[model samples]
Target: MQIASPLINELQCGERLNHAIEHGRRGEFALLLAMLSQDARDMAQFTLGEEGTVDAKLRRQFELPPAQTLVADVADDSLVNNGGEFHELGLRGFALQQALKPEALVTRGPISVTMLDALNNTDPLCKSRYLEPQHPALPEIPHFNDRLSGQLALAQRMAQA
Candidate 1:
C-alpha cells in the first residue's frame, strides 16, 4: 500500500482538525488532536535523531509552528471561517517551509528526498487512520516538484523503494 509522508500526515491532521471545528464535532476534534500530537512527537524524534538539535535554523527550515498556538487557534471557533472552516488548516507557511528546506546532508539533487524518506519510513498505518476519507478539507498533496524540484527526487526514491 502506498503510504503518506510525515508532511502529508501533518497536513491531513491539520485538515481534519479544521473540519471538526467547522462541523462542531467534538469527537472528530479529539481524534485530530491526538493525531496531531502524536505526529508532532514522531517528527520531533525523527528530527532529533536525523539532525540533532532544534536550532533556530532547523526550526525555521522545518517550519515547526508554535504547537500551543496552532492548537489554540484551531480550538477557537471565532477564528474559523464563515463556513466554520479554515483552509489548509492555516498551515501553508509551515508546509512550504518543510517542503523547501534542505536536508542536513548535502545532495546533488533535490533536498526533499531526505524528508520524503523520513516521511515514507514513518509508519503509514498510524498516519493514514487519522486521514479519514470523510474529511474533505485536506490539502491536496502537491506533485513532488510543483514548487521544489526536490520532490521529484523524493518521488524517485519512493518508486525505487
Candidate 2:
C-alpha cells in the first residue's frame, strides 16, 4: 500500500509498534498479523533491508488514532451493538476482514506456544517479535557525566546572564 522506507518496526524489526497492542482487542492482534501476506512482509524487508515489522504500517494504512492507556487483561465483547466502540474508530472493516472467517487464527488470550516462539524469533513479520526487539542495547554517549555537567553549567551561566 505504498509503504515508505524503514518499514514499520518496534523491534519486531522501533518502540512505535506498542500502539497496536495497547489499542487492539485481546488476541485479535494476531489476526491482523496473519492478514499481512508473507509476500508483503518479505517485500517490506527487502525494501528496508533490515527486516520490517508491520505495526506502524497498519496504523497509518488503516488511519488508526493514537492509543490510550489500556488494561492488559481487558475483556473484549466482540459485539457491534454493545457500544459500537470499534465502529466509532472506523475499525468495522478490520473486524469484518479478520474476525468473520478463519476462526482459529484469531484468539483472545495469550498466544499459542508455537505462535509465541515464532514471535520471539527474528521473523520480521511476527507481531510478537516487534513487541520485544532483538539485540536490544542502549547506545553509548561520549563524555558520560561531562555532558550533563556541561549542560548544567550552561544553564547556570544562562541564569546568571
Candidate 3:
C-alpha cells in the first residue's frame, strides 16, 4: 500500500498540502473518482488511533468537489481488507472489471478506483428486503447494496436525470 506511506507523510505535514490528487480529467464519474481520491488524501490526516475519524472526513469530502492535482501518486492496496464473502466478491469484481475494460484508456483520463465496492455489494442487509422491489439489484444478491437504502436514500433523492 504505497498510498499508506504517502498518506502518513501527508498527515504529518511533510508538504503544505496534505494529499495527493487522483486526477479525474473526464466528466462527472471521473470527477467523482477525483473527489474520492481527495477523500483518500483527507483520510490520511488522521493519526494511528484516530482511525474512527475517517467517516467524518469522508462525509465532509462528499460535500465538496475535487480540487486540481498538484501531484499524484498511484497506490495499489486492493487486497488490504480481504475476508469472508468479500473474497468471493473481490474475485467476481476483479473479473468484471477486467472484462469491462481490460485496458484503461489513456485519453479518457482518470477512472474511478472504487475500493471494496464488492463488500457493499455483498452486504446481507442489501440482499434483504430493504431495497426497493423495482430495483435492478433485486435479482443480483451480490450487486444489491448500491441500490436505494438508508445510506443511499439521500443519493436517490438527489439523483440526476
Winning model by lDDT: 1
- Candidate 2, lDDT over the whole model: 0.48
Task: Give per-residue CA lDDT, model 1, range 1-161, as digits (tens).
Answer: 44244333354565666777888999977765664534445553354454556665577798975332222223334332222122444466545544444222221322244554554555554435444453322344567567577777788899999
TM-score winner, 1 or 3 = 1
The per-prediction tally of clashing pairs is 0, 4, 0
lDDT-based ranking: 1, 2, 3
RMSD of each: 20.1, 21.6, 22.5
Q: Assess every candidate by TM-score.
A: 0.21, 0.19, 0.14
In model 2, the runs with Cα more than 4 Å from the true position are 1-74, 79-110, 128-161
Q: Write the per-residue lDDT of candidate 2 for residues 33-98, one digit (tens) a residue.
A: 554445544544455544344766778789976443222212445422322545565677556644
38, model 1: CA deviation in Å? 3.7
- Model 2 lDDT, residue 8, Cα: 40
Worst lDDT run of 10 residues, candidate 1, spans 102-111
Q: How many clashing residue pairs are found in candidate 1?
A: 0
lDDT of 3 by residue, 44-120 (tens): 45434644466567767688433323322234322222233335677777566545434232222122224234434
Which candidate's TM-score is highest? 1
